[model samples]
Target: MGLRKKVIWITGASSGIGEALAYEFNKKGAHLILSARRTGELERVKENCSNHEESVKILPLDLAEADQMEAKAVEALAMYGHVDMLINNGGVSQRSYAVDTEMSTVRKVMEVNFFGTVGLTKALLPEMIKQKSGHIVVISSVMGKFGTKFRSTYAASKHALHGYFDSLRQELYEHNVNVSLVCPGYVKTDVTINALTGSGEKFNKMGKGQKNAMPPEEFAKKLIPKLAAGKDEIYLGGAELMGVYLKRFVPGLFSKLLKRVRVT
Candidate 1:
């Protein structure tokens, strides 16, 4: 279906890729329900969209507050009728060494990336199933495909998403609800700085490598159409996405290569 009439609900819309997708979809004529913890940033993003004159409702939220999510969905749905798609885009990254990482840090990341996605999707599945058509787009990462240096917990969180969403797709296929996962390498975002560490505080700044990553707006411009056409899984990045396939076929060499990576 065309994006023009779709009522899309996106989490983490305050900044980064989510904000970029907001504008992209708005330009394509989709109704938007933007959710994030920062209302001010959401307002700025809402205003930036080319079709600001259309319905653009902002819902402030912390995805990690998993218990209240269903109610949040209720409130969000009330804004626009039925949600045509729910983008599970809110998540935190882990930046400390796993050995030194506290249980709390790992749990927090899972809470947002894994459990939060689960809760929200679960709450909405029945409605979508009843409607017989819906799309759940998950924003996972290349880290989801393989573990890397300095990102053990982050890797685990993304890995968990692949497991969960893949199974959901299989289970729901007969019902006509589509679940697609997007695996992106790195886009220019404040993710590293906002990432959490062992003590449950921010990593405090962006990584050196992330400073030169692709811009979010450019990434979305390419990603939206593929999603609209029902592509099952998508991987976007320069050469980094190649590593996913390399590891699958020539795993021994891939393992050796990963040793030399100084991931920031």
Candidate 2:
């Protein structure tokens, strides 16, 4: 029942939380399939794992390519004959106002963050159902629970994830497949640097909150235990975590306070 020898596929494994998870899981003797659009970086991450030669493999993938995910899912399953868990961590972030954001940028974000994730999950869902055992972990954001400035579209995609996965949890209950939604507040990752602006250009700068965010390694360490405990949904991060509660308990007060938050 522990992570030992469990085959876990982690997308966005080239860096940030995914990379950190790879290392942590590797130490626990889990077999890993690391994935991302950056094959070279994935290889580097593989090399750093505990038993790189036999315990880890890399699969290059672009979550934006929703059309190809079903095929990729087949390929992923073939890597180890079965996958005990799939971590849907590949996604893009946003850094622009709704009015200034172009339709194309909005669509691109949704495509990669929402549709792409769903496509890949659907591709793997049948197998999980057939086996009657599997775990689906989604790396959503605090924005999923509440709206914030400069993250309208990004928030929308994450919100969509919650709705889709919450329903999925109920549907898969009888089948024994588990869905865990991880809502991260702020982590010190390159997400901000690569966030898309209204013009569809990279933001290229880290925000104050991001710079002061939790380290991915620490975040991963704290997360795995909760995940292993079979939590359905978990909120992880720093001071920003209060937003999740305030949004639920004090909707009006939270809305007024959200307006003053400097999300960038």
Candidate 3:
């Protein structure tokens, strides 16, 4: 029941949290379908995993290309005959102010973070419903629960994910398909450096907060067990996590505090 032999498909598996999750899942004896836009990086991740030659398979995917996800989902299903879990982890972040950011940049963020993730889930949903077994895990963020400066579109995308998956969990309740949202705080990843800017360019510089964040490997180690236990939602890392609750319980104070925070 705890990931042994489970066919788990992970997107964004080329690096960071997704890469760490791949190793953790591999160690837990789960067969993995590793995916990302970079085939070479996926292969590198696969090689670093346990029993890669047999249990790991690389599936290069670009989440922004929403049109291709259906076919990719089919390919994923064919690999292991059935996917026990689908980890929707591919996404991009923003580091530009709302007014300065181009509409194209906003749409691009939505395409990769929200629409694309939902599109793939929709593609695989029927099969999961038919089989009446599967888990849809999303790597959302603490930003999903609250707004922040220079991340208007990024926060919007994650907020959309929360709404979509929350509804999906309710609808799929009888279908035996579990939906889990993982809201990680500040995890050590290339998120800030790869974040999109006003002109749709990468920020290319890491934030100081990110440098002090929890290690992706350590975060994955704590996360996988809770996920396997079927947790509906899990939060990890720093004091920013407190904002998730404060936003709910003390909106006024949370709003004031959010404005003063150095979110970058």
TM-score attained by model 1: 0.97
How much lDDT does each candidate structure score? Answer: 0.89, 0.93, 0.93
**In candidate 3, residue 115 scores what lDDT?**
91
* Ten-residue region with minimum lDDT total, candidate 2: 255-264
User: How well does candidate 3 match the true structure, expressed as C-alpha RMSD?
Assistant: 0.9
Q: Against the true structure, candidate 3 has what lDDT?
A: 0.93
Runs in model 1 with CA error above 4 Å?
Answer: 51-53
lDDT of 1 by residue, 1-264 (tens): 688868999999998999999988888889999999899999998888766766788989888988878898898778877999999998988888888899988899989989988998998898899889899999999999998888998899899999999999998898899998999987999999999888889998888767888899999998997898888898887788888998899999999999998888
- By lDDT, the better pick of 1 and 2 is 2
Taking the tens digit of each residue's C-alpha lDDT, what string does model 3 give over 14-92? Answer: 9999999999999989999999999999989988987889899988999999999899998998888999999999999
lDDT of 2 at 34: 92
User: How do all the candidates rank in terms of TM-score, highest first?
Assistant: 2, 3, 1
Q: Score residue 133 of candidate 3 by CA lDDT.
A: 95
Q: Clash number for every model?
A: 1, 0, 0
RMSD of 2: 0.8
RMSD per candidate (Å) reads: 1.2, 0.8, 0.9
- The TM-scores of all predictions, comma-separated, are 0.97, 0.98, 0.98
